[model samples]
Target: MIMYLLMGLTAAVVSYGATWGARVVGNRLELHMPIRSRDMHSTPVSRLGGVAIFLGVLVALIVASQSFFVKDIYRHNFSPWGVLAGATLIVLVGVADDLLDIRWWVKLIGQSAAALVVAIWGVRMTIVPWVPEPIFLENEMIRIVLTAGLIVTTMNAFNFIDGLDGLAAGVAIIGGTAFFFTAYWVHRNAVLLDYSDLATLLMAVVVGSCIGFLPHNWFPSKIFMGDSGAMLIGLLFAAAGIVSTGQITSGLYDRANGISTVIPILLPFAVLFLPLLDLGLAVVRRTARGRSPWSADRGHLHHKLLDIGYSHRTAVILMYLWTAVLSFGGLAFAVFPWQPVLAADIFATLLMGLVTAWPYLRRGSDEPVA
Candidate 1:
């Protein structure tokens, strides 16, 4: 536990330094994300923030590979390298899109290619969820295809919500923190010693990167993460989920009842509930209006909050609150009695709901009872 925390701190420090370097390079190269119709920022900002985040994760992983406690993970398998390669591939694709505004199909192809790289290197999804029997995707081909599809989908889902300063990075921090704890528990409890806490290690790096990046990305930002940063975050999350939940054994599932069985299946989604929900809504809303799902618009939840009179910082913070509540709730379920966790989650959700609606309701009351 202490080792992972130290690794995360290492990642954060490296990422912070790398972000400053990236900003300077971006300015020199004149690479900026121009203010678009759907964007919130008024001025053009450097979009090379992803490069810094990637560097931070890279340096931390390299250090981990040399560490006495974690070096065994490298010898165990090549899956960790696969995540690095995939992250590198996705960041390149994102950088191109950020600079050139590449065609949607081209970006999709790039995402698929990156996903395939991770899948082929033995991080394929091996287990199926929500079934009576512990059904594992034993066929190597099926596992690869499922894993790639999931990675691609998750990348896009996160990309869709990178609309506000610090939103994507902050959410990644929340999700990665949740992932680390759950993965750590599974590693200690389960019989899958071969995985060697790979998911936890990956998330430690991810959360650290986001922590390092958030200051530069906060409201009235100096730099936007652009497609590269958001997609990299999503890919890392998916890869960690694959290694964590996708490796659960039937023995663990069968032996434990109550929350344990469900948590392994639900933990990934619980952490990413908001982004995935926004993604689902965007696809449906666009397709219904005969627009391409990839097309940008101001109908996102964050935009809605803005339209309803929330300040930029407040809207982002509220979203963070919701993400934290859902994420930590799931983490609690895994460790404690489900009944209390569920009750607390419900109370927290109601409080958030009231907080969200209070402004509008107060405005209505101020209006002359017409």
Candidate 2:
């Protein structure tokens, strides 16, 4: 536990330090993400914030890898080296894209390269929990493709939703926290006796990095996370999901029978549901309008909240609470006898929604579109 806390602290301090430097370097390089018409921020901001996040997670994992518990996990085949290599590649791609406006195809190629590293590291989703038996997809080629696809999808999902201030980071922190607890639960249960504590430790570093960076990222941001930070975080979030969910060999997980075996796969998606929904909407909306999905717009959920007269901080806070409710509700279902509190969660969120949107609701149903 102490080692874990130290790992988180190391990540936090490193990230905070790196963020400070990233700001100076970004400003010095004149590498600002100019305020596009569709952008929410009114002024240009420095964008290579991923530099800090990358360093944070990199150093944290190195320190964590030194722990005997973590070392044992490595011996059991959960190696951080491969994930780190891939993450570094992705971060570079993101930084280059942020600084140089790399072509989309080139960016795709880079992301795929990172995915290849994941495959080479043998990180694959071998089992998907279902009733009666687990669905096995351990064919090396298939696993690589599937795992790589998931990583890319999740990475893009986050990239797509980096529309509002502190949006992606906050969501990530919520998701990472959920993932950390879930992973810890799995590790303690020792259901598979295969995976190590890598998932939990990775999540700790993730949560720590987000917490560290939030001081600079929230509300009126000092620097945007840019593609660098967003994509780096996306990759880490996906890595934790993959590690926690991919290793189980049997459908009969949770021998004590609280959550089902599929919780590993289900949990991350539950946490990311809002972002994923936003991504899907963006793609569909863009396609319908014959625009590129990569094109920026102000049609995001945050935009709607803002348009409805919610202050930026309030909007962010509302989204944060919404995300928390959903994430925690899912966690409860997976690990606890949550039926008792389930209705309360629903009522509370609904009530909060009513309160937040009451002004718009009272005035009229018609609200201005961004």
Candidate 3:
């Protein structure tokens, strides 16, 4: 616990320091990216903010690995090393894209390659908990392909939602917090080893990084995370999800008791449900409009908020609130044994979703085009 707190603080300080450094370097190098939105502030801001957060996380992880709390877990599994390598690759690729406006294909290739590396490190998902009996894919190639696809999809989902200031970071913070508790719960139940403690540490670092950076990122932003930060965050979260859900311990699901292990698997998606849904919606919306799915547009949820006369700060706060509600609610359902609480959580989630969409509801009757 002390290690986790120390790591979190270290990550926060490192991330904050990086942000300061990036600001100086970005201005010196004239690395300002133009904003296309009329709703945005007049001044151009640097997009290399993510470079700082990436560095902070990298350094914090390295230091934490040597700590007593992390040493055993780090030595027992090579997964952390694999994750670090994958994160470095993705961050470098994203930084290149941010600096040079690299081709979309090139970015895609990098993401795919990173995903493949993680999969090659045996990070593939082998079981679907909803199905009776453990369903293992007999074909190794199929498992690798499916796992890589999941990682890529999750990575892009996070990247796609990085449109608004403080949006992706806030959502990530909430998701990371939820993962911490979930991992801790699993560890406490003795279903899994203390390695979940490592997940908690990672979560704390993520939370601290986001919180520290939010001051610079909120509303009229001074810096943007750009692709560098967004892709790195996405990749790390994806890997964490894979680690947490893929390693199901014995007795995790008692089929006769009507308990489902799908809940744990579903936890990641639920924590990140909003962004993933937005990505899906974006693809459909773009395809329907005869544009490439990867094309950027003003049809994002934040854009809709602006169109509906919400302030940037309000929109961001609303997003943060919704993310927290969903992520926590999903986690509560997953870890708690009581059916009543789980049912109540489900009801509350549905209610919150409705409330969140209330802004869109008022502007309705005439369907607003995306």
For model 1, how does the per-residue alpha-carbon lDDT over 1-370 read when each residue is reduced to its tens digit?
A: 8888888999999999899988888888989867788988787789999999999899999999998677788886888898899999999999999999999999999999999999998488987765554476779999999999999889998998899899999989987898788777756666665545778898999999889989988988888888999999999999988876665564443323364457776778988888999999999999999999988898998998898899999999999998898888888877777788889999999999999998898998899965
- Could you give candidate 3's per-residue lDDT for residues 1-370 as a string of tens digits? 6777778788889998889888889888989766566326678788888888877788888888888766666876777777778877888888888888788788999999988887777366665444445465768788778878888888888888887888999899888888777766666655445543545666777777777777788877888888888888887777777666655545443321244566566678878888898889999999999988877787877777777767788888878877887788767765565577578777877886777677767768568678
Q: What is the C-alpha RMSD of each candidate to the true structure, in Å?
A: 1.8, 3.2, 3.5
TM-score of each: 0.95, 0.91, 0.90
Clashing residue pair totals per candidate (backbone < 3 A): 0, 0, 0
- The candidate 2 region of ten consecutive residues with least summed lDDT is 249-258
- Residue 266 deviation, candidate 1, in Å? 1.8
Clashing pairs for model 3 are none
Clashing pairs in 1: none
Q: List the residue pairs that clash in candidate 2.
A: none
- Using TM-score as the measure, what is the rank order of every candidate, best first? 1, 2, 3
Over 167-266, each residue of candidate 2 has an lDDT whose tens digit, in order, gives 8889888878877777766566664564457777778887888778888888799888888788888777777777767655533336424556657656
> What's the CA error at residue 159 for candidate 3, in Å?
1.1
